[model samples]
Target: MGASFFSFSFSMVSFSSLRSSLVPTRMMGVEGQWWRTSGNHWRAEGRDDRMRGENEEDSKLSLDFTSEEKMEIESIKTYKKDLLDDIQKLKMEIDSVMAEILSFESAEENKTIERNKQFSNGKKKFNMDPKKGINYLVEHKLLDKRAQSIAEFLYKEEGLNKTAIGEFLGEREELHLQTLKAFVELHEFSDLNLVQALRQFLWSFRLPGEAQKIDRMMEAFATRYCDCNAHVFQSTDTCYILSFAIIMLNTSLHNPNVKDKTTLERFISMNRGINNGEDLPEDLLSKLYESIRNEPFKIPEDDGNDLTHTFFNPDREGWLLKLGGRVKTWKRRWFILTDNCLYYFEFTTDKEPRGIIPLENLCVREVPHPRKPYCLELYNPNSQGQKIKACKTDTDGRVVEGKHQSYTICAASAEERDSWIEAIRASITKDPFYDLVSVRKKKVINQTPQD
Candidate 1:
């Protein structure tokens, strides 16, 4: 049987009324099958496109990749195409259904067949123009009647007999529910599709919590964007949704001020030793510090050369985001630390990364949590000289009274970065009296790191 669909965007909502918390009441039904309103509430969701086509040659590139990577790339290339084709098929089917409705009837016909046997079964079903039928029902609301207990009365209304009303309502209800069902089902399909779409990206980038938050970021972006304001969250890998979200986030939501590039640079300059890597050159640490300190707010360029990009006021404005966590440290001897220090860099829209910051220069300060003592700390590897002092110095990190305490930390991954911004911003607006701009802050000093 052909089905009639309920056409509504995700944002489309109708309500009897909604009450806030202060207006308390307990009027919800206690026993009725809440779901029985219609066997038709669930509708099918969107499907993945069977065909994936990336206009970018790099998206389909097999060059500079290992055999294994190449195979994965090929698979993705194939899957994307398949997904694209699937969406086309659904679109075509919807068109066909719409065309069919041009001849479908909208209401009951009083003309009598009198059970006459011209076609065989003693009774013949009547056919009506789908379009006129739709117009009639829409204009009259003949097909959307709500029976309180739909299931108990399902197919039991004798008055609905021999009329187009029964056929129209019955089929429409199924479609309405089917549409909702399809709506949700599409997400499940997209879940796999998204993972597939990002398979290469995930393998290519060494991001923290890469897959974990891509879904949420795209979701928030979709909500932040869409002109239709559609809230229907389908699959997780919603780049399309994200495209919409960026538009929304930019145009509608309250925007936080671009952080101070100078302040950000001061913080990084004061604490620049954390990014030293074991794999990097023996002298890489010194150069890395010099590079990071020189231009703490610059983006790396790809012109076969490195320039001073960390400086605050470059010709171009961008963002510099740095995240790091402590792995291990030696003590009283080699890579020893008298205390622990954590740091995170919150940069201006123009801040960019010219080079990596060293671990010793790292200082992480958390935006105060609701009920906990907030912390800011700086880790200075050597107080005096670079050489390992042939002997131990002053009572080993002598206690400096009530000072900063270090805690294990995690940095936001590229995927979680946007979501983390959301989480952080939510806390910022929680206190009505707190205005970020009004608050006075100096080049805040992290309490000297204490063990």
Candidate 2:
């Protein structure tokens, strides 16, 4: 009985030990499950954050795309608006041309009715020859009227269509006819080719805007050359236009002083006298040559005394030598001598002036050139020694304060130097109001003592 009881106690102790080991194993399993759950939660949160960032980026891209679309729409609208404005302007021009055409047609109908009535009554007063009508229109300086008449005469009286005209005329004549047709059709503004042709026609006149009467006369002659004057010019006549251009240029030279001359004056001035339209005369040619040579120095006829009152004169251009700050350097500059100021540009015509020297309170003297052969010095006693911004120099600058500001300029030749000096002196001495006094003094000096 004692042995059995001891064995039972040992078994109970073994069972308790086994149960303690099983408890530790279960606790480790629970701790691993809790850690895995926490890791999964952290990973899910990171994924959510990534998705949110992607969504924000997508939204910004969409906004940028929307703005681009808006800008494109706005640009298209602006282009459309510009096109509409141009179309509107073209419509207005068309309306004005239509009005002119209506007025012209009404006047033509009235004249025609009157002529037909007179002819029907056996008066026999009307000449239906288009040539005579065109000649009269040209002589009257009715250019716009001539354009319509010539077009009608070509189309109706001659029964010449565009294709027929092209087949009948030479290549040059065909082109001229086509240009006239375009002008008659009044599509010149819309057609770029016709516009260029019209510009060429206007430029052939070689006169100012104020010369409207001359312009009209020239235009009439041009239209007549295509119509009534066709008898004078053959299909192969290339010299007609060239001869006319020469005659017009010669006329301008023959009488430069005549401001209000007629087309007849221009026609008479030609060596061939309008009938043949030849070159200029020897006297006129010589005069043109002389005027061109002296044009730069000549004072404008309308404003001869501008030098006494104005600060700038844009008509004259020439060359001069300017002394650099360095002792040995002299640069050639294109100088423009204005009324009260002198500006120097670069040697090229397109470049703007580099410096301006005011002639007011200025004194000029011929200086013996050390570096420059024929030099002159201009001094302004009132100026400070301030260096001109346009006068770029490397050595020392001229004094531009209290003392005189001196500018030394050179000339290519002695004659040029003398001319510049004389011009400067004349500019300084000119008194516009003293012209009457000078004339009176001259008259008194010429008068006899007995009087």
Candidate 3:
């Protein structure tokens, strides 16, 4: 009798393919003798003792191989699991790097925008000096001499006495100077005080159906005096009436003694000398006084010394409700429109603005809203047909990038909305380059021979 033996081998293979190729191949083995001692039983005969020993050895080898194969399978499974974990970590790192790259790109874009703005502003710096540019207009005869007189009054130039005021008022200098002097004395107002009062009156006065009258008068004044308008002076009478009204309001507002306060009767009495002894319409006076009484004019403590407080000014500052960017909610903010920039604050008295929006390359229009009335929107017309982002301010006191391509604001009434839209549009065009171009064009026209 002879014992049988078997041998086995394995090779490295992919985990997925290992299962399919795991079948053991057949191998030659030593022959062994077998005899039947009972039904379905095989046993070595007594004389084949050495063969039995060999058979036991073969059995041990088979058992050892099976155990080793199981250990290898477990090791391969652990390696696969570790590989998957490393792949997951690599993916996360890649995502983090991508985020940082996007952040850098956004910052670079903002820097470029800021540099361009500075360059544009530098070119317009000389034009922005209202005093200098206005003087030039007067010398070149683009504006009336009276315009120069008004600028002198606002700038508080040396020798700006009552005589100068009379000069600015032209033929009616006597009555106008009397009224202005009396008003100034009654309120103990300095030239600076008067300037601030005029600003407060303009910002706070609003009468139903009469809003356009004030706007038109101011437009005429700006055209004649501030060089902010290109059109010829529409009406000197309108400008005179506006100046008188400002004086009367300053008298009405500034007296500290409540007992001697200027009443509507006093207001009417003081202004009766205007327009050649004809009184202002009683109805208009009554309404204006009522509005002022209801909301007494007071300049914010912070804006007391601002140049915009003067009459030869181009600013529209007040409170308005602005829509939030991320929250999509309405918030009341104090807004100031001046010098081709729109700035907003959390409160009217805040010394520093929360953010500033450049008026360049921007347009404002009234838009219909589903849930809110008297809505106006500021947006760039060159957005290439994308929905504009809402305006928002970051911690650095500038508009956050990728946040505001547009701003939607709400006013107290439709008239207020329209007024804001008009003011914003006017500011967009009120630049030095426009003023020079207007003057040159007027010069060319005047030099041409009559037809």
Candidate 4:
């Protein structure tokens, strides 16, 4: 009975172990099925959420990039506007500087003119006597005996007043154009003489702010004597316009300042405002410029005694090629023949002469140059001593010595060369005494009974 009970208990224990193992296997299969179903759904939902978050992040990054690009464009626009403002400011500053410079120059010129006028007035007040003035001029070598004789003749024979004689004598002493014009009018000068006088008056250094004076003078002269007179144009305004145009042309041609030069277009624009705000005919303007450029106003020959009375007056002045003595090179010089001296300057506007060649003993003759045409030479036949007088002075008032014995010059053309030669010869022989002597001889012959 005890063995049978032990066997049953052992079977019961084995059954219990087998059932425990089987129950664990069944529970594992059921849990695997549950995982396959619910776990897949949860994983799919998580993956969708991650993809949506990534898309939102990408959109946000794109929006940020666009905003950054817009900011960069606005920055460039702002920078460009700033640069333009700077350029505009710079232009305004430049214009202001230029205006100030012009104003200063004008003021300085006015001061100089005023000082000169005061000095002239003081001298005039001090020297009131005409005879004393004549004596003074003669003693100073400003007038030769011949010029004095002419002055006497004009006073005694021509019945000219002391004022006219003084004007003529003091022409070189800062005479005004208005005074000169009055003198010319009093003499009742012919048209040619009038033009010659005007030409001489115009051949001077231009002063700052003198354009208005020039314009007025030109207009007055044109109205009085030019073909564009008021009678020529039915409308007075038209005549004035024409006269203004002529004045503008004269200014452009005569002004020596290179910066003041104007082109045809600029010239037209300048006049457009004057012609009732209408543009002038291009062809007409062009033709005027061409004509003026080709045939400038020239001082005609004086067949009368107009030039004979004037002493130390400029006879011929123009550009010439001068042979340098030391450098052995050709340099352009402005030559002016006055009285018995041939003065040269580096520029036409130079107040001082570079050298002076006395025509008293010098003779000018055409000479053949190896490589130049229209050449002439001025030499002293009597001596080999220096012919050119040095004009440059040292601080101690000593004359610098760089003079040459001879001068070789070249002109632009044969006509110019011949003109210069004739002018120089005339100047050398020019003496009012010779004319007086000739007149006296003729009078003596006439007074003598015919044989």
Query: What is the TM-score of candidate 2?
Result: 0.26
lDDT of 1 at 392: 16
Q: Per-residue lDDT for 165-263 in model 1, tens only? A: 223322335542332222222222222322232222222111111222223333332333232233322222233322322222222222223233323
Per-residue lDDT tens digits of candidate 2, residues 49-103?
A: 1333545544543543356644653464366457657777999999999999999
Which candidate number has the best TM-score? 3
Which candidate's lDDT is highest? Answer: 4
Candidate 4 C-alpha lDDT tens digits along 1-451: 9999999999889756533432211221212211111112111122211333545544543543356544653464356457657767999999999999999999999988876565444335323444444455445444443543443333333322333343343333333333334322333213432233344433221111122333344433433443322233233233345444443455466544324766777766654533233344677567666665555543223222122223212267899999977678998989998767888888888887877777877778999999999999888778877545435443464657646778899999996887687667667765322343333334433442322
> If scored against the real structure, what TM-score would every candidate get?
0.14, 0.26, 0.31, 0.30
Query: Ten residues in a row with the worst lDDT in model 2?
Result: 30-39
Candidate 3 has an lDDT of 0.50
Q: Summing lDDT over every window of 10 consecutive residues in candidate 3, give the lowest-scoring window.
A: 1-10
Cα lDDT for residue 177, model 1? 38
- At residue 232, give the lDDT of candidate 4: 31
Q: Which stretches of candidate 4 lie over 4 Å from their true place?
A: 1-314, 384-398, 432-451
How many Å off is the CA of 19 in candidate 2? Answer: 99
